[model samples]
Target: MPKTFYQFLMTQRNPESYDTIANFANNAFLDSAFPKQETEFDPLSKYLEENAPYLPSMTIFDDAWQLYLASLA
Candidate 1:
């Protein structure tokens, strides 16, 4: 079975430049409402923007999304 997004994320080396995303991912591991199963970026981005407005930037999510997509290849 494919791993959940959060599961896949946890295996990643946390990027130093994107510490907030790493922190968010760590916290997301505990959020039952986080869409861990979703593969698309839109909903995931929306979730973060709405639920985690404190994140300083979305660049990390964009970077991580690229990594996630590459992992599938």
Candidate 2:
């Protein structure tokens, strides 16, 4: 089975590459309203843009997302 977004983020391939994203994922995991299961980008993007503890560049998200998509295959 494919991992959830939160699951994927928490499972680090390279600890250094995901430092910021892992921090955000930790935060997101705590939030009751976070859409942890949804794989679609737009809602997740909006949530990250608005609710992140610190603003991470969209490029970081895009790269993470590409990896997530590949994992689904």
Candidate 3:
């Protein structure tokens, strides 16, 4: 089966090679608050690492990030 967005994020061994972060970072998809542009993307990965404890155990990074943004609204 194909991986869900969350599974992809959680198991991403090399975020640099991952495509979504690059795409999302472009065209204001990601907020300016993001620490770095996609060229130097690690904060997203670091965010997953730092918040791993509090985030849901389910594999759904997209939803997790969405809710996080929603909280800011």
RMSD versus native structure for model 2: 3.2
> What is each predicted model's overall lDDT from 0 to 1?
0.72, 0.71, 0.40
Model 3 lDDT at residue 49: 51
Reference-based lDDT, residue 69, model 2: 86
What's the CA RMSD of model 1 in angstroms? 3.1
Clashing pairs for predicted structure model 3, backbone only? 6-61
Candidate 1 runs further than 4 Å off: 13-21
Off by over 4 Å in 2: 13-32
Candidate 1 structure quality by residue, lDDT tens digits, 1-73? 6555666677763546456657656666666778878877889899988886545678877877777777777
Better of 2 and 3 by TM-score: 2
Model 3 poorest 10 in a row by lDDT: 32-41
lDDT of 2 at 24: 56
Q: What is the C-alpha RMSD of each candidate to the true structure, in Å?
A: 3.1, 3.2, 14.0
Q: How are the candidates ranked when ordered by TM-score, highest leading?
A: 1, 2, 3
Give candidate 2's total backbone clashes.
Answer: 0
* lDDT over C-alpha atoms for residue 63 of model 3: 49
Best to worst by lDDT, what's the order? 1, 2, 3
Q: After superposition, how far is residue 32 of candidate 1 from its true place, in Å?
A: 2.8
How well is each residue in 1-73 modelled by candidate 3, as lDDT tens digits? 3333333333433435544433333312333333333211245656545644433332344544554444435
| Candidate 2 per-residue C-alpha lDDT over 8-53 given as tens digits, one digit per residue, 9 for 90 to 100 | 8767434344476565556565677777787788998898788775
Which candidate should be chosen as best, given TM-score against the real structure? 1
